[model samples]
Target: MIVRRCVGLLALPLLLGCCVVHAAPPRGFDVLHYSVALVPDIAAKRVQGQQTVRFKAEQALSTLTLDAGTLEVTSVTQHGRALAFAQAGQQLHITLATPLQRGASAELQIRYHGAPAFGLTFAPEREEVYTLFSTSQWMPSVDAPDERATLDLAVTLPPALLAAGTGRALPTRTLADGRIEHRWRLDTPMPGYVYGFAAGRYQQATQQHGPVQLRYLSVERSPAQLRTVFARTGDMLDFFAERAGLPYRGDYQQALVASTIGQEMAGLSLMSEAYGQDVLDDADQIALMAHEAAHHWWGNRVTCAGWEHFWLNEGMANFMTAAYLQQAQGEAAYQAQVDGWRTRLDALRAKGADHALVYADWDAPTADDRAVVYRKGAYVLHLLRGELGDAVFWRGLRAYTVANDGRSVVTADFQRAMETAAGHSLQPFFDEWVYTAGTAAQ
Candidate 1:
C-alpha cells in the first residue's frame, strides 16, 4: 500500500524530473552480454552462483555495485585477466585499478556462495537451513520487483533432482558422478523476484495439444493428487484465454514444490507440495490456483512499473480469481469471495489503516496494511467495472493487456486505457483509490 509522501503544490518540476523519473533503478547489464551459473540444493537450502556481467560505462566511475546478499566473492576477473574486487555486505564493490572510459564495454566475472537467509530467524544450530521468502536469495542482481532483464543461466544439480524455473531448459548432459548440467536460456526479461528455482525428486507429466504443450512437475509420490491438480490447468488456461484474449505463452509448466507456498515465475509456477497432497475442500485453495493462473497475464505480462504499482499485480489477480470462480462455479461463488473481500476491507478501514492501493517502496507492509491493499485494491477494480458496465470494462481490460504486454505498467497507463474504453475519464475514482488514503467515497 502507498506510503504517503509530502509534496508541495508548486513542486511539479522536481517531481517530474527527479521523483518520477528515477522510479526504477538503472540496470547494470545491457541486452547483449551477461551470464550466470546458479547452483542450489533444495534439500539443504544452500545456493552458489557465478555471474559474469558485461556492460559499457558511459563515464568514469569510482565504484560499481551489484545487488548481492550475504555473498562471499571467491574471485573476480576482467576479460580473462585478474582484477581486484571487494564486497561490503549486500553491495559488491569493484575497485578498478584504473578508470574505465565512457565508450568502453567491460566484463566482470564474480563467483560467490551463500545460503539465502530470509524466513530464517534462527541459528544454524537450531535449524539446518533457511527458508527464503524471495528468489533473490539464490543469486544477485538488482533484486527488486521492478528490476527486469534477460538472463542466460547454466545450472548444475543432482541427477535425481527435478528442476523448474522461469526460463526454457536447455539440453543437459550427464556428469561422470551422475549429476546433470541443466542449462536454461531466459529469453524474456523477468523481474528479479519472479525468477525461481525448485529442485527435488519429481515426476513430470506432459500433455500436448497441437503446438501448445502443457506440463506438470510434481514429486515422485503424488500421482493420485496430480490427477486433480493437472486436470484443472487446461481448463484454467482456456478460461484465461477467453477472458484475457490470448493463450498462455512460452514453455508453459507448473511445479508442485516442497514448500507451503506457490510463486509465479515467467513460464512456470511453483505450487507447494503440501497443498498438492493435502486436503483442501475450501474455495480459498481453488482461488489461490486461479490467482496464480491470472499472474500469467497480470504479473508476468504487464508487470508493475514500481513497487508503487503493486496493486496492478495483486488487485488484478484478486479480481481475475473471483471472475474465474464465477465463470467456473457460477455467480454465487464469485459473489461470496467478493463479499468476503469487502468485509475484510471494511475491517481494515475501520482500524484507520487504509492505505493507497499502490505503494512507493518494495518493503513488506504490516498485516493491517496488507489486508487493505489486497482487499481494497480488488474492490476498486470491481467498482470501476461496475461504473464502466460489462462491455466497456471487458474491452478496457483486453486493451490494457494487449497494449502493455511484456512491459512495466503504472497507474496512469491503466487509467488511460480504461478512460478510452469507457469513452470518459475515470481520474477521480483512481485518484481516490490510488493516490489518497482512507475509504473511497461511496
Candidate 2:
C-alpha cells in the first residue's frame, strides 16, 4: 500500500522553549483587495489577469509583504499616478517616495499578465483542468491562513464559457467584440482559496434546504449524471445541521468543474468533473459533500491561526462530516469508512512519515505531507470524539464555532473551548494528537 508522511505536529515537542510560535490574531478588518479580472484560454494553456488592490497599513512597519506568486508586471500606479517598482523573485517591492504613516489608505493599481500555472491544475488521464487562485500566482498579500479578508472580483471570460464562484453576481456586461464580464461581490470575509472561479459551458440546478437556498452546477453534458451524483446535498445539509448543530451558511452552492479538485468555500464549493463522476456517487458522495459543507463552519467561519495548523481545519471538518454521515447512513457504514481511512493512516505510519502529523513543517511540503494533514488529522479528531463521547463532542464543536466565528484559532484555543464545553480538561488529547510524533491507536 502507498502511504504519505505528515508534517507539523511531530516537530513540536523537540522545539519546545527553543522559540515561541504563535500566530497573530485579527486586529481588525484592514484591507480590501479587488481582483478585477481573470481571463484564461485553455486551448493556449495560459492565463492573464489584473488586480486593483486598496489597502491600509494598520501600523507603520519597516518591512511589509503581500502574498504573491511568479507573475510579470506590465504597469504600476498609485492613486491614478504612475510609480516605479522592482521585483525580487516572487516578492513585488514598491517604495513610497515619501514614507506613508499608519492609518493611511492607498490604492495600488497594478496591471500584470502571466501564465499562472498554479491556477490551472491538469489531470491528463481525464483530460480536465481545475482552476483556482493560489497566492503562488499573480497577486500578493500576507499569504497566510490567519489573514482572512474579503474579496470583490469581476471576471472577464470568453462568451462561450460560463462561470461559478462564491459570491453573488450583480450583472453581466458585454464588451464590444463579444467577450463578457461578470461582476461578483463576496460581502463576507473569506480565505483566498474559497473565492475561486471556473469557466466552462455548465448547467445549474437549484433547490432550497430549509432557510438556505442551494444550487449545484456542472458541465452541461453530465446534467443527468450530476443530478444523480449530488442528489443528497439537501439531506446532507439537514443532517449536518442537526448533528453538528450548525446550519449551512450563505447561498450554499456546489459545482463540478472540468477539473479534478474539490474544495469548500464559505457559501460555494468547486468539485472537479472527474471527482464528481467517479468518487462522488451514492453514500460516498454524501460523505464528500458533507466534508466540504462542514467547512462552512470549521474552515470558513473560524479559520486556522495559520497554514501550520491546517489540520485544525481539515481534521475538524473531516470528523464533523463523518459524524453527519454516520447519523444519516448508520454506524456500520461510518465505521467502514473510518476503517478505510485508518488503513491509509496505517500505511503512512508504517512508512515512518506519520511524524509529519505533529510537526509544523510546511515550509516545502511534499505530496505525502498533504495526505497526512487531511487523513491523519481526521483520525486525530476521531480519537478525540471517542474520548469525549457523542454529546460532549458535538456540543464542544458547536460551542467552538460559536466562540470563534469570524476569527482564526490554534490548538490551544480549540482545546480551551472544547474543555469548557466538556466541563473537563483535554490537555492529554491535544498533546497526543497535536504535539506528539506518533498516532494513537485507532
Candidate 3:
C-alpha cells in the first residue's frame, strides 16, 4: 500500500521492539485451501459467493471459527450435509457434525452475499469492479499473514468485462445465464490479504518473461501509454531477483483503476490511474513504482511474523526500492531517497513522535508511526549496508530470503542471518537503531 506520510506526535515504547498485540491466533487447525465462486452485480453494488474452506486439524476439534466481517453467511455444510453455524459480529462459528479428531481434515462450505461497505469497489460509472484490501471483508477466510492457504477462484461477471486475479488463469466458461465464469488457480499458499481480482473494460497489454506473464491493464491509458508508464517493470523484477537471490515467482499484473491510490496483492497490484498519468508527465516518478513492485518479493513472499515486525515488509521494500533506484536511475536518485527518508525522521523526531521501529500495536496508526516503519525501517537497512559493505549485506539478504522463503520472519531472524554472514554479532547495531528510538549513526 502507498500512503503519503504526514506530521504528528504519538508516544509509544516497546521492549526490544518485538511485542505485538493481536487477538490470540486460532489454534487446532490450519486452513489448507479456499475454493470460491463469486458473482458480482456491479450496477447494484452487491455480490454473492460460495466459499469452501479446507483445513487440517492439529488437535481434536468439534468446532472452528473464521473472521467473517459483516458477511451474511447463508449456510454452512460439510460434504453434502448441512452443519450448524452462527454469525456473531465479525466471526463465523461452524460446528462439525462429527468431532474432527487430531490430524483429521474437513471442509466447510460458506454461502454468503452482501453489499460490502469496504474492501471492494463497484464503479458503475467507470464500469469497473475491484478489491482493495482486508480480504475477510469481501470473502470469509483467515486474515493472518502467518497462516497461508492456496486459492481456487471463479468469478461470474459481465461477458463484456475483462478480469485478472492471483495465480494462473484457467479456461473461461459461459453460464446459461450469459455471464462468464473467469477462473484462476493459485497453487502456492499465500496470506489471504493478497488474494484478490479486478474486472473492467480495460485496455491491456502483455509482456512475457520466461514462464511468467507480465500484464498491464488500464481504464484509460492506451497500449502505448501503458508501456510508457510501466516500461521499467521488467528491469525492476530482474534487479530484485538478482539481489534477493530468489527469482520472482508466478505471473504478475498491474492494473490502473478508477481512483487515486496504490495497493498490491500476491500477484497483482491496483494502482491509481492518476498516478499513471503522473508517470507519463515525469520520468522520476519511480518511487511508488519500485515500492509496490518490490512487495512481490519482500512483503508477500518473505513476510513478517507479526505486525510488530512489519518494518521487515515495508522497510525492506522501501530500501530495496532505493537500491533499484540507484541501479536504474543513478547514485544521486538513491541518495536523494535516503536523504528524504532521513528528513522525514528528523521532522518526526523534532515533534517527539519517533519510536522504536517495532511497536506492540498498530490500531489506528498515525502518520508519524508509519514514518518509523516505512522510513526508519529503510534507513536502518541503508545503515546496515554501510556497516557490512556490499558483499556481506547482499549475501545476508540472499541467505535470509533463501532460508525463510515462504515463511514468516521476525527481526531476530534477519539479525541472525546478517551475523552469520558477517561472522560476528550484530546485536549492538540492532539495539541502537531497531530496538531504541534515536538518530541513525553514521
Of 2 and 3, which scores higher on lDDT? 3
lDDT of 2: 0.65
lDDT of 1 by residue, 1-442 (tens): 1222211011111122111222555444332344888666555666678887766665665456666667677877777776777767566677665666766677778888876665211122212122233544456565545556777777677676666656888888787888887777778777655665555566777776445577777764355556556666667777877778877776677766545455676777666656765523443357666777788888877887776667788788889888888888889988887898788877777777776665553354666765665677788888888888989999999889998887788777888889999888776777666666646334
Error of 3 at 293 (Å): 1.3
Worst 10 residues of 3 by lDDT: 2-11
- The TM-scores of all predictions, comma-separated, are 0.86, 0.87, 0.94
Identify the runs in model 2 with alpha carbons over 4 angstroms from their true place. 1-21, 24-30, 61-64, 121-130, 136-138, 243-245, 279-284, 356-358
Candidate 1 minimal-lDDT segment of 10 residues? 5-14
Per-residue alpha-carbon lDDT of model 3 for 183-301, expressed as tens digits?
A: 99999888887889999999999888777788999989998898888888888899999988999988889999988467778889888889999999997797887888898888888
> Distance from true position, residue 216, model 2, in Å?
2.2
Name the candidate that leads on lDDT: 3
Ranking by TM-score: 3, 2, 1
